[model samples]
Target chain A: MVLLKLFWSFLQIGLLSFGGGMAALPLIQNQVVDLHGWITLKEYTDLITIAEMTPGPIGINAAAFVGVRIAGVPGSIIATVGCVLPPFLIVLLLVRLYLKYKNLSAVQGALSGIRPAVTGLIASAALTILILILWGENGFSTNLESLNFVAFILFAASLIVLRKWKPNPIFIILGSGIVGGAIYLLL
Target chain B: MEKRKSIYRKLFSSTFYISAFTFGGGYVIIPLMKKKFVEGLKWIEEDEMLNLIAIAQSSPGPIAVNTSVLIGYNVAGLVGALVSLWATILPPMITLSVISMFYSAFIKNAVISAIMKGMQAGVAAVITDAVLNLGSNVAKKKELISVLIMLIAFIMTFFLKVNVVLIILFGGLIGTLKVVLHERRNKGGGE
Candidate 1:
């Protein structure tokens, strides 16, 4: 029963959340943290942090991670299948429509509008992550000492490196891990 | 027939291996797919690959999976599509499952926790970079309507806290309406 519920919830997530992996964060957060009490907000953030560190789309990693925590290996498999099912089927159906009338101006127009909206969604995702990194629990950080200065610095440095170098993400991720470990050990 | 089977097998393995290395989202795989399918295999033309990408972007799934499906379907029909789809997602599913088994130990370690913090910061930066890249490409269009849609969508989500699905729907509606309105204007005045 729990496995079934997990599948259903993630299926809803896969269906509703559009734009990309980042845009799915809020919905996943609500379902896991508020609705089911499967994980706390802090844990949810940590899960995403780990998900980002891992090699996969953020959405897939989150589903797999959360599923395993709630229902073990079977739970993870079911949840992942659920998460992927909607998009897979939807895209498959759309492929027919797309290949047939891809040249239509109306289709082009709709796509143009969607492109910018997607950008906005991605921006908001970054904002959400930024706030979480800077403030511990929620956006309401009363104590300044609780703020993580090292993370803030790392965020800036990472951005600069990415813009200037355009290096492979694996290097950046691994480099951050080493730098973070050093910070933890030294400070 | 033997050659065809070999090609299909190559597609499956190539997609699987490329997918395993995909660290971020679908965006990261686009260039890799181009290299593998376009330059390496010489199976699809450059223009055709671009067309597939455009279609994949407009479709409703992860672009990586969508593109893989598109290319596979183009090459070898439904069976190929299924094969490519499975290949694309297999790595992440396997990796996540293994990580799940040992999650407790990793979570408890202070060193891992700190490393995650740094990685989180790195991820935040990467997301920001994606937004800027997408936004700048949109800016290159130099259309007032597109800019308006972009701003309105941004404000609606960031400030008004409107649901993302609704925003996307609204964008589509406005976009279609804009195109229709322009068409009517041209027909009524010039023609």
Candidate 2:
């Protein structure tokens, strides 16, 4: 029964999470923290860190993390399955539809429109994280009181490295991780 | 042509490798997949890859997973899709399970948390770059409707906190309407 509940929670997460990893965090928080109280807000914040830090999708990582916390290995497995099931099925159906109607004007227009709108959501998500990291999570502020200059520097450096050298992004992430550790420990 | 069995193995291994190696978040994996499939393997065409990714995002669920399954199905079929999906999610499960064992210790570690904060800054950069790339691509199309949709969607999401699903649906509706009107206007010309 506990495992069943765990599965159901993550299943809802998979179904509802549309945009990307950052976009899904709130819904995951709502299910695991707010609704079920499976893990406290403190843990949810940690989950975000680990989820973003770790490989693959945040939704899958969160499911595995929470499942383990709640019900161990079996719980995590069940939750992970639940998390993936919806998208697995949904995308397959969409693929069939797209292949058939891809030539249609309506489909083309919808694709064009959704592409930009999706980009907008991604832009918003990036800003959300930037606000939290640079200004704290209370929303963007003009006071500059909580602005983190080190983070700003790091963000600038990473952007330059990415735009210029075009190395694998993993290198930038790992490099920033090291730089971030040194900066914060000194501060 | 390569044997179907070998192709399946290649697909599974490629996704598995990417899944295991990719860090930060889902979006990070996409460019890597494009590199592997479009450039490295030359199996999927450039526009085809974009179309698949677009559809993947158009549907619900994690965009990474959605993209992989679509790519897999596009390449190999349903069985290929299944292979890609499994390969994609397995790494996170294994890695997180181990991390969960040391959850408290991991969270409490000063160095790790500091690194996390730093990694987040880097992640923000990466994601911001991705946004810029996507935005510029939309801009390149030189379509006013999409540009306007992109702006409106940004305002709605950032300032208004609208659910992304609704925004996506709204975009789809607008797109459909634009094309329908376009077709009607052009119907008589039949050109």
Candidate 3:
């Protein structure tokens, strides 16, 4: 039953999470944290942290982590499969339809309209992450003032370099870790 | 026969490499695809690549998966799509399986934790930049309406903790209605 629940919950997440990993965060958080009580908020935070550091998409990582947490290896497989299945199915259907109506203006217009909405979804995702990072569990307390600005600077700088230069993300992630460990030791 | 064999080989090789290296899911795969398929192989022109991205974005699947299918199809039809999809998913599936095996030990590592913190900040920025670039490109009245709808959905889900499935359904309904109404107006004007 727990494995089934994990499968069903992640399946729902996969079906609805349109804008990708970052966009999937709040939904996954609500599921794991609020609905099932499978994981605590801190654990969710840690999962996000770990997912970001790891090699796959955040949504997939969350599924793997939560799946393992709930029902072990099988759980992970179930969750991952559940999360991936919806998109795969949906795309297959859309591809068929697209091949049929390859030049319909209505289809074209509808797609154009969706572009902005998708962008909006992406923005909302960014806002949610920002709030989580800045406010933490207390919801906007004086604690945010204590954020490691130096760490923030390094992060921002590394990202800027990444954007302009298009360096490999793995390098950036690993290098940032080293820099972070050094900073942690120094401070 | 020789020509067909070469095409199959190319398709398999491209799909295999993409599946192996793509970490962090679909979006991360986009840049890499741009590098490999567009820059490296010249399989698709930039315009076609951009159009594929736009289509993938508006479509109902994971963007990376969708793109791989589309690109693969464009290159070698159904066979290509199948190979690309398999390739795209293989790496993560294998990696996740291994990671799951040692999940507890991996999570407890302090150095991993520190690195994750740093990467989280960077990932956040990447997401932010994507939003900004997208917003700048598509910021108009209709776009604003879409943005507003998105904001409402976000607030409802994140703050009010409403079900995200409902939010997506509602967005889909609104999008459908807007398109239908616009089409009707256009028809009326034509008539």
Which candidate comes out best when scored by DockQ?
2
Q: Where is the poorest 10-residue window by lDDT in model 2 chain A?
A: A118-127
Query: Quick one: best lDDT, which candidate?
Result: 2
**Per-residue alpha-carbon lDDT of candidate 1 for residues B117-184, written as tens digits (9 for 90 to 100):** 67667666666665666678678889988788878878888789886667777777787888889899
Fnat score for model 3:
0.32
lDDT of each: 0.74, 0.83, 0.65
Mark the regions of model 1 whose C-alpha exceeds 4 Å error after superposition. Answer: A1-79, A140-147, B1-84
Interface RMSD, one decimal, each candidate: 4.3, 2.6, 5.0
Computed on C-alpha atoms, the DockQ of candidate 3 is 0.29
Instruction: Indicate whether candidate 1 or candidate 2 has the larger lDDT.
Output: 2
List ranges where model 2 is wrong by over 4 Å.
Answer: A1-5, A16-45, B1-10, B17-54, B57-59, B189-191
Better of 2 and 3 by TM-score: 2
Ranking by TM-score: 2, 1, 3
Give the DockQ (C-alpha) for candidate 2. 0.60
| Candidate 3 local lDDT, residue B23 | 40
Measured against the true chain A, the candidates' chain A TM-scores are 0.64, 0.79, 0.62
